[model samples]
Target: MKTFQEFGLEPKILRAITEMGFEESTPIQEKTIPLAMEGRDLIGQAQTGTGKTAAFGVPLIHKIAIQEERIVALIMCPTRELAIQVAEEIGKLGRFKGIRSLPIYGGQDIVKQIRALKKKPQIIIGTPGRLLDHINRKTIKLDDVQTVVLDEADEMLDMGFMDDIQSILKLVPAERHTMLFSATMPSNIQKLAQQFLRNPEHISVIPKQVSAPLIDQAYIELNERQKFEALSRLIDMESPDLAIIFGRTKRRVDELAEALQKRGYAAEGLHGDLSQNQRDNVMRKFRDGSIDVLVATDVAARGLDVSGVTHVINFDLPQDPESYVHRIGRTGRAGKEGTAWTFVTPREIDHLHLIEKVTRHKINKKPLPSIAEAIEGKQKMTAERILDAMQSDAYGEFKGVAIQLLEQYDSVNLIAAALKLLTGEKKEIEIELTPEEPMRARKKKFDVRSSGRRVGGYGSGGSSGGDRRNDRPGGGYGSSSGSNSRYPRKDGSNYGPRDGSSGSSYRGNSSSEGRSSSPRERDYGSGSRDRSKTTNNS
Candidate 1:
């Protein structure tokens, strides 16, 4: 394995890597770095969390002269979250070398990005559609680009950005080195490579071996309506020390966080739109265990190294196999056992098979924990807590009080009452989450046969594509479908009215005054979806 220093990187890039706290090269980094530095067009098949960024980034940074401007390197990612994540990591890797990397994606202010363009960054990371937009506007000049990378190329293909990718490629110099990384290689991806790359060196890492062996993977078949309830029950049963819930989009993250909070869980949402300070605070609270659950989109949670994450729940299945691996990788770190549960809607089973094939692991199908099971799990935790207290001699002061209580009540009853108090029976919350357009299903070519019972967007009947929209609630973020975007949005920019406070409360109408029958309808139909239900007896 080659080290960063052995790869002949400049002192500034090494300093930046050291400052970022990385010492060892992950397998992809070790293999890809040497070839990338040699200026070979390379194709890397590696999983996320395997440090592929540094593999492509190090060489890209090395080739950029301090005086070069107008994007010496360009990276196109599938989503805004990923675009920002890659840009941030690339910036960190290139910081000391005077190599500036900027993230340009839809749903952010084109004007703001235009202004940033004026600063003349050396590297540009953007989603396909937005990058094309910048190209058309003449805001980004790719003539100086010496290298270009398509990170998570499969995802962009799945999101229908292939045409845009080709269009952007045409604007750049055809002589640049290109690195493409994807966990699964579809034929279309191969076609794109063939069209753009010049006899690339193929480096394929075995996918099944990439994931941590300690992580236990499972799936629960659930209908969309039962999802929130199932998640609540699962939390009661699992009692994770710390957990990260992955949602597919920004709206899903915001809704899940709000719903979890309403149910009295110490939870918060993290996405691309949050200021660095806000993202930092949420992360701090999560690392310190102040928050039991963190709801986040994939982009926002990238590069996170929190060690105590005991569980990972895929509230919504990701678009491709690579994202599934990345989501599950958050747990099962530091040689510790972890659990990952994905909620599969009946329609999304095919996509699940795709993930299983790419990961080469059979995810065991698990029954959803019922309300009773949740109660039992809580009681077990209480029992363990009591046993621990006894072992630790924590009852010295309470012994006399316990004796006094025993005299008034039967000892067994007193113990049962104590357990009941500690266990805390589960509370059912009726939460209405705003439904999102399910991710585009991969064409039949990517599907591989698997036996796991599937649900959600991976089910057999799942909706694949929808016209993209960017209107989201709160000051939170929205997923840009490679089109017009207004990003770095303020509290006032969203559809739902806000009072400009802590980011809650509807602006126009209260959720209490019965309005629309569904969350999506409420937003689009100018009404509200009340959690309160009125039953009618026939």
Candidate 2:
């Protein structure tokens, strides 16, 4: 709870943080800023919502001179969404300091990145694959980089960026200060740190608690094809005062919000692709309760501190346990009770258990609401509205019309018409959302109990981990619908043509092409296990 000024930050940076409404430093920021500013190589271990960006950003910004043109600080991330989010936050921290940072990632135009590189930004926040592309083309030079940070180091290893990360590090000046951050220091991550960092300081903030216990947690076991219908019905049933719906990607958020609106929900979408003005506008509406539901990607929801959110729905399950905790943390603020619901495909049932294992809390299973049930819930809400209207003096002028209508029509029938008009087509709206590949959860061990219960990874049996990859023709933004085959990715080896059906060891392949396949394949994490029916080992 200490102030930013207590960390020895300069006046300009302090001003920026204050303007951003961040008067106090979060746990990770409190421990990291002083050490990072001392030019010490450090390893910080913290969960997703812990404010790691400013932990590294403030020091990097303070070290750079105003007019220095060379890119002095380099930050690497695992996803384009993460890269963009980091860059935007750093841009704010350095706004008055005259430091500039640019984000480079796949799916965005490479020509556009090249143009941006020409502007001589002082910092570059990029994904490994896209950074390698720029390196191969000789567009980005790290010769002058004074500080190189491997932000989310474990994620890079998880995503199969070990080689790229090593190569990028080798290219930077040998004397540079290096820092690495991860949520957990697994064997691979520890090895990377030992190989790359100096006698680095280690810091960690493992959250020992979960969200408020007053919040109700539940999950709906359903099929992917029927998820939207279930979601529409659930909204009508719950009637949240304010809701936040978490989607996995930008495309998913945009489409889901649009479809929800078409189905008669007051909703808006928030993602990293939006400009600051647009994000601000959306946040404004959400705060004032103008929009009842806000559909968002994880990157967009990070560090958002709004109260009065009654429900948080994971329309798509998160990739990690940390992300799941963050999504649900949006609600249950200030001792007020809240509720959270997750939609889990059958194959992902074990994955849900994995989340339970991590958080050490069992989520209750809930039945999907039926259409008639949803209508009944709506009818109750309408009746409440009618009662409130009947008590209020504001309806005095309309009494004559109400009497006249009752004379011609049955009183109950006239009220039914009013209810229908108010609710406006509560169910049965056709919406087609392009299917997204289900998230892959980590595996620890698989076991079968005598009562027909399976826990942990559940091995390669039972179900093919919900083989919905075939339905995802174009999973990402720039991919084409003509082929389910992953596009040729910028980062090689993981997506396709790597080592046959053995598949890519890493989770995310920055390429367009997917994984190799035999008659049967498994998706653990986001590793490419393309069911393309063709071998990917070139």
Candidate 3:
């Protein structure tokens, strides 16, 4: 890693970078900054959290002349959230130089963006759809644009934005700097680069294993009916400060979030069906620690950059290895150690293995945590809290009452009572989740001709095994299409019908069709008394 100052950055820019706590350049930044500054077209292949934003942002900001106010540079992203995030980072980098960047995206008032355009920002960061809209409406001009960046180019292709990107690129000046960044370079991306870039330098910073090395990866094999219980126990035992739970479909995200909240956990769901404002609120709460768990679909969580994410839980497996890499990449950022756990049904073991083989990282098997273990973990947490209070001398006011009780009862028993009161008994809530069909392992093939579809395998939306159009409302970019019938179960039995039918009931220790109250009452023993008997199979 090289220092930012070694890149010959302007003093003001270096000052801003230093203030932002960027002491050294990441691999992507070290390799990209010099080439990009030398006015060459380039393609950068790197995953999220690799500091790609700054890798491109620094040079873009450095090149901007504050005197020329009319959109000198344009950056196109796939999602509104990403557009906003990139704009904010660029804003910080350019603050000292008096260069301005404005973010334009859909789901916000176009009138407001048009007004902001009047202020003559030197840079424009926007989604492909909204950018093309502005182009057609003559609200934005690209005649004077000197630099163009396509951030997350592959993501835009997944969302069916290739044509829009082409149209936008055609409008830019013929002789100008162009840079494309993507996590994976599919045939479509390669063809696009060949057509648009003039012998661009290709730089790949992807690790041998796509997953971050700092992430401790593991998986638990259990039955479909046992997943919720397994997840609850893991959360109890791990007690992650902040966590993300990935689900396969919109319905799955909703059900899991609701079930988690019902169990007295602070959680919320993020998916495409949410309005922009609702999505913003959920992300805000998760970022501010008001909520500890975020349940999200793959597309909804795309390009999300939140710090302090301690854990990533795959309640349902991703559709492909790339998506798996993206899911875990949310945690273990900035050289911080994090944990990731995946729940695999017995039938889906081969699929999990497939992910492992492709990513070249072995996922260790973890036993399902017993209910008694969860209780013990809670007691440990309570003890830590008590010890912290003691160290802080915060128990001074309660010392008199403690002394009074100590005289009457054994000190150990009184301490146990305090732990019990602080660590409330686990709620015996019957959480019902819609069981997702297990994924089957299959070989992937790359298709170059398919620009509108996923190149190698199913899109994120296709993993739901239903109509992709219905999963994403408004037919917006980032909507993926595929059929679930491609892979059949090993038992020669097909998955449940996609029709909104209750395929099976996931009641306590039962996989029967209909719900039974008596079974749950019998299974949920009184106050963890019989919980030790609950095995992993249960």
Candidate 4:
């Protein structure tokens, strides 16, 4: 209920917050800001969507003087996406004050980073690995750091970056304030606090519910083979302003995106294999309303913050309850009501139930939409548009044309013609997706990171899921080890395979099994589809 002004932020930072549309402080911000501004080491335990970025960022920005050009604050995250997001948020917060923040991460060009470094940014936001790389190359100096943040310490530990974090922290001056944030604190995270922070003030902001209350969650039980058809029907019915379809693997993202395109949906694929530029372009298109749907693996979708996502479709169920929460959380943001639908295979119903139990939210079950219903959905939308136009008196321009057409035809026939023109015919596209294994179970735990999403939940991939060693081509995991969601997600967790083994042996690669990339060959309605602009975001 508290406003940013209550935290005693300076006028310049307050102006930026107002410009960014933040009127009130989130629970995390309400608690952490005052202490952080007082130069206290702090630890905040909260989920991603709770405004933790500003919780720490505002104070960090407030402390840094515009006259000091050296790096005074450094934030380390587990992934490049999170690093970029934090940097952008901090940059916006410090805009009016002329505080400079730069993001340095691996996938991006190091030479460019070196050039950015030369600009003497007073703050640096970077992933641990890349930060260490720069530290080793002597491109960065941290002795001037007045504050250091382990943005998602648990995730860095999960990704085996604990040593790097320690090393980075050690490089900072001993008299610096340190802030660490994480959703869950295991033993390792506590040890990290003990070593790095000086009697840090702990602030915990627990939400009333783990999942977003504004999201209307539902699920349809169906066979895996029938998923694409069911999803297409749902899309036709809902016609979301913007939607994200979460796939379990890279191939699933690619195949589903292409399949949706085949059925006349404006969709794009996002996965780890995508070049940074390609990822940026796809995200740009999604944010600008050029793409209607984004099919993505969990890793690829991490740290994604686009508003106006009206719906979140679990084309494939997430690996765990936490992921389910995060997946649906993508929609229903900015206090707007959103819809989330999951496709549950017959055997995966139990896994869905497990997710329900953990998030303490019930997922309504519904039957797959039939062909007639899909057509009816489209008709209903067209009718609504026409009615709105009539209400607004905007139809006056079309009244003369309507009268002219009616003069030559019966009113019923004329209305039918208008309906036909307005409602697009349902496409009978035959989409055959490669079957994937379901998750072993839904027992895997997800840490709520500062960026508001898990950094490494997609099993051992970077930002998006991919086998880094073999350079495996798949972007999604639903078809890989996480397939067969009927079982537990973690190999050895209480939800693991009943046989007591990891169950990874059954997973297989389907890429060798023939697929046509040329969308022109796949007939959707009547003509060849043009896919020259299809992005290889994967």
The regions of model 4 sitting more than 4 angstroms off are 219-232, 239-337, 341-370, 383-418, 426-538
- Candidate lDDT scores, in order, read 0.71, 0.74, 0.75, 0.73
How far is 477's C-alpha from truth in model 2 (Å)? Answer: 16
Predicted candidate 1, C-alpha RMSD: 11.1
CA displacement after TM-score superposition, residue 211 of candidate 1 (Å): 2.2
Which residues of candidate 1, in runs, are more than 4 Å off? 1-23, 45-50, 76-85, 95-98, 103-116, 126-139, 150-175, 180-200, 249-251, 273-281, 425-429, 444-538
TM-score of each: 0.73, 0.75, 0.59, 0.62
Q: 353-401, model 1: which lDDT tens digit per residue?
A: 7677767788899998998888877788789989998999768998889
Flag clash pairs in model 3: 159-478
Which regions in candidate 3 have their CA more than 4 angstroms from the true location? 79-81, 154-162, 184-191, 218-235, 239-338, 341-371, 382-538
lDDT tens digits by residue: candidate 3, 1-538: 8999999999999988976657889899999999999989999998765688899999999988779878889999876556766876798798998998898864444567789899998999987766765776698999999999999898777655677789899999999999999989999999999989988999999767767899999999887778888998998898888999999888889999999998888999998789989999999999999999999987777668889999999998876676788789899998999999999876578788878876779999989999888888788878888888888976778878878998999988888888899988677898767566566564332334344333223223224233322322222222223322211211111222234344321122222212222211111112111112111100
Cα lDDT tens digits, model 2, 425-484, are 754567778665554454333222213322223122245323233334334334345543
Ranking by TM-score: 2, 1, 4, 3
Candidate 4 lDDT (Cα, whole model)? 0.73
TM-score of 4: 0.62
Clashing pairs in 2: 486-512, 486-513, 486-514, 487-512, 487-513, 489-511, 500-537
lDDT-superior candidate, 1 or 4: 4
